[model samples]
Structures are given as C-alpha cells and as structure tokens.
Target: MISACHQCGEPIPPRSDDIQLCRHCQQSPPAFDRTHAAFAYTFPINQLIPAIKYNRRPEALGWLSLVFAQMLEDRIDSPPELLLPVPLHPWRALKRGFNQAGLIAGELGRHLRLPVHQGLIRKRRATASQAGLDRSTRSANLFGSFRLTGTIPAHVALIDDVMTTGSTAQELARLLKGAGAQRVEVWVLARTPTKG
Candidate 1:
C-alpha cells in the first residue's frame, strides 16, 4: 500500500523527504500524532456504520473491530498504554442506549489486550448534531464541551466508529495532550472524505 497521512490517514503523494503526510497535515497538524482507519466511509461502510449506530446493531462493530484489530496487529509494533473512546454527552448516550465509540473501544480492547478507559473523558454539555455542520461550526460547537474526569496516560489511543472531519478527535486530543497525554493517536473504523 502507498503511504498515507501521518495525522489523518488520508493517502498522500510521495515526497522528497518521503514523509507520509498530506498537505493539510503539513499545513495544520492535528493534536493527534497519527491516525489509523480501517476503511473509507463509503458504500457498504456508510450503510454498516448507521446500522451499528442508529439501529442498535452492535454485532457489526464486533466484526469490524476484529478486522481492525487484525489490521493493527501488523501496523502497531508498540501498543498504547490505554484506549480512550470519544465520549458522547450523557443525554445522547441515554437516548441512544449506548456509545458506539465505547462499544468499539471495548471490542478493540478485548482483542488487542489493551486497557479501555471510558472515564478519562466526559462530554460536559450537549451540542447540535455535527452531521451537516462545517468545520468551523463543528469546532465552535465542541469548544469546552468535553472535560477530563480522570488522569490521562502518557501514551494513549482514541477509539471511535468513524472520523468525519476529525473535529471531535481534535478537541479530545487537544484536551488530552493539555492534560498530560504525550502520544495521542486516533483509531477509527472508517474515515469519510467529506465532513459528516
């Protein structure tokens, strides 16, 4: 496979320095150091992710996380000390009956033998749906929306179902790094080209 963005996992052209990074990453680096995506948020994945999120079909995450684990086996020479899932607001979690990111993190933890820490971060307030929002709006909406509930590990990975514009990852990672996390990586099931 060709090299991908070191920050967001989007494919990038080969360069003289051979840095596996996209122009966007070079211009404005994300808070997370690296990203690992199992699939693009397209076609079947677009459909499967909704079933797992809205339709309460967790089995899909099970299978997907397993595949993601298998894929990571080769890429991850050294695993992080902990797995932190992108959290949902209490109201959202209560209404949805579950946090998809938490579920994915649980499955990944079980397979990869990593510790899952859902309590490290908490969504402090509810925000509008990010589904159709622009990047600036999304960032503004999430500002100060999450707070740290516990200590953060120096080396950790953020787990989630999908990465749209990475606004959530940016917000969470920025918070984690500020709170003492040294190496923060993002592991998502899929990454969409457009912000979702």
Candidate 2:
C-alpha cells in the first residue's frame, strides 16, 4: 500500500515502517511532548475510521490497537501510570453506544499492560463538531470542558483517535495539570498535518 506522509503529503513507500512524519515535522514540531501514530489519516485510515465510528465496527479495534501499540512501543520510554481517553459527552456516548477514543484507549491499556482511567469527564456539551472549526473556536468550544474526578496518577497519557489542531489535547492537558497530574503525553492514532 502506498501511504503518504501525514505532514507533507509526500508519497510513502509500503516499506516505510519507521516513518510517521515527513521532513517538515522535524523542522517544526507540535506542542505535545512526543507523538507517534500508526498510519496517516488518509486512504485506508480515512475509510476505516469512519466505518468504526459510524457503522459500529468494533472488530476493527483489535487491528487498530495492535498497530498503535507497536508504534507506541518504539517511541515512549515506558508505560505511563494511567491512560486517559478523551471523553465524549454523555449524550454522545449514550447515542453511539460507545466512545471511540475510550474503546481505543482500553485496547491500548490492555496491550501495553497499563491501567485505563476514565477519570476525565466532558463537563460542557458541544453541539458543533471540532472538524472545520478554527483553532480559536475549537479552543472556545473545549474551554473548561474537561474535569477530572477522583485521584489522577502522577504520570498519565491522554489517548485519542486523531490530533488535528490540538486544542482538545491542550485543553485536556491543562485540566489534567490542574488536577495534579505531573506530566501529560498524548497518544493519538493519527496527527493531521498542518495545512499550508
């Protein structure tokens, strides 16, 4: 399969096992500490993601988690104390019968032998999807959105399906920090390249 670089949109060979970003990412990096993704959010990924989300294809999760775990194993030093999934609003979760991020995070926890903690909750309900929203609007929509219940582990990793503008991760990290989490690492299945 021909996969393109998630950052620069350059053609990536089928054997490009060790690459996630193009040269551009090395030049200007994201705010998160470390990011490793299984596949670029295009082609097969684009097809698979929506299928899993809309069609309720839970079977795809095993392969997704395996790919994610392999990518993560090569990047991080060790497993974090806890894995925190980016929470969906209760209504959305109820409607969908599952949170996609939560399912992926649970699989990651099982694969990595780490604990999955659903300590974070979405305090604010968002009617608009984050997609197509500007960074400022995204920030506003997610502002004061996440709240942590009970004790948070000293070291925690936030898990999500994709990292786009990163406002969601940033806001969640801020909440985690406020809740006494000493460090936050983002574990995403894909990171959308910034558009030029």
Candidate 3:
C-alpha cells in the first residue's frame, strides 16, 4: 500500500486517522506542488542508487528509469509538458562522466513521449555534498546554485535520482517557479525516510 504524505509523498506508517500531509509539509509547504517517489530509499533500492551514481554503472540507468516510469504512470494522471533533470555542476559532471538524473530523465521522456529539456537549467556552482547535512544546511548549500536558461513550460516535472530531505528539489522548484513555471512536480527514483 502507498500510504504516504499527501504533499511530499514520503511513506507514512499506517494509522486509523486519515492524516494525509506529513507534519513538516503541513508546517512549511514545499515549492513543488507534489512529489512522487518510485520506492523507499532503503535496503536494496538504496544500494542500486549508489551503484548507478558512484559506481559508474550507466547500464543500470535504463532499468531504474523503467521502474520509475511505471511508478509515475500509476500515480500521475497526466504527463507534464516538460521534464527538467536536476542539473549537476559542470565540474562535477566532468568528474562523474555523466549526470544520472539527466540520463534517467531522457529515458523517462522517451517512454512517456514528453520532451526532456536539458539546458533549461544549469547548476551555477559546486556545493558541498548534502549527504550528512541537516535540512537548514542543505537548503543553504543549494541557495542560488541553479540558474534557469530560457523559457520554462507552465507545467514541468523535476527529475532526480533520489530525494533525501527534498532540499535540492525544493531549491530547484523555487527557481523553476521564479522562471514562470506555474506548477512544478518532483519525480524521483526513491525517497529516503526522514525523522519525524
């Protein structure tokens, strides 16, 4: 069963009351209108993300994209006008040899028959890894890191490999909204559970 926060889509424990939104999302709304994660960032799925990201297993991206696409098909009623992959700093992209998010977005675009716009946004600078940072620090680190290039569609989906605290997605969504995107949705392969 997909019992999760109504806004962020983070998995929630089953309960009697029909509480939809998570406490954090209720207190402070995210820039994205909604989020959909294919799987919980746990156990085997967590291992797969690192393998595709750090281990340079570009071949695994196809499988991951298929899984995420199926999840999106099940959750979203309609496809967004455009797919915007969360960008990587140029330097980081060079070091990594590929942007995993971009690859996944391309695959998903092909499957969903939507346009994937790679150059719509660029990472302005490299920042510290958000692996161990708290929510506030993560938000600060990503501040002003994204720059929108040209016109953005009214509806766009921000694609990413995984969402931990959602700080990165939130930052990018804010930028997209500022650039005239009326509605932004976050689509990710997985979502790491957060502490309540």
Whole-model Cα lDDT of every candidate shown, in order: 0.88, 0.73, 0.88
Q: What is the lDDT of residue 178 in candidate 1?
A: 96
TM-score of each: 0.94, 0.81, 0.95
- Candidates' RMSD to native: 2.0, 4.7, 1.4
Ranking by lDDT: 3, 1, 2
Which candidate model has the greater lDDT, 1 or 2? Answer: 1
What is the C-alpha local distance difference test score of candidate 1? 0.88
- Cα lDDT tens digits, model 1, 1-196, are 2456878987555667867877788899999999999888888999999987898777778889999999999898779999999999998998989999999999999999999998788999999999888888999999999999888889999999888888999998999999999999999998876432
Question: Which clashing pairs does model 2 show?
Answer: none
Residue 6 in model 1: shift from native, Å? 1.8
Report model 2's TM-score to 2 decimal places: 0.81
Q: Residues 1-196, candidate 3: write the lDDT tens digits.
A: 2777867878887768877888889899899898888888888988988987898888898988997787777788877999999999999999999999899999999988899998889999999999889989999999999898899989999999888889998999888898898989988888888865
Q: What lDDT tens digits, residue by residue, belong to model 2 across residues 16-50?
A: 36766556556854334444556667677877887
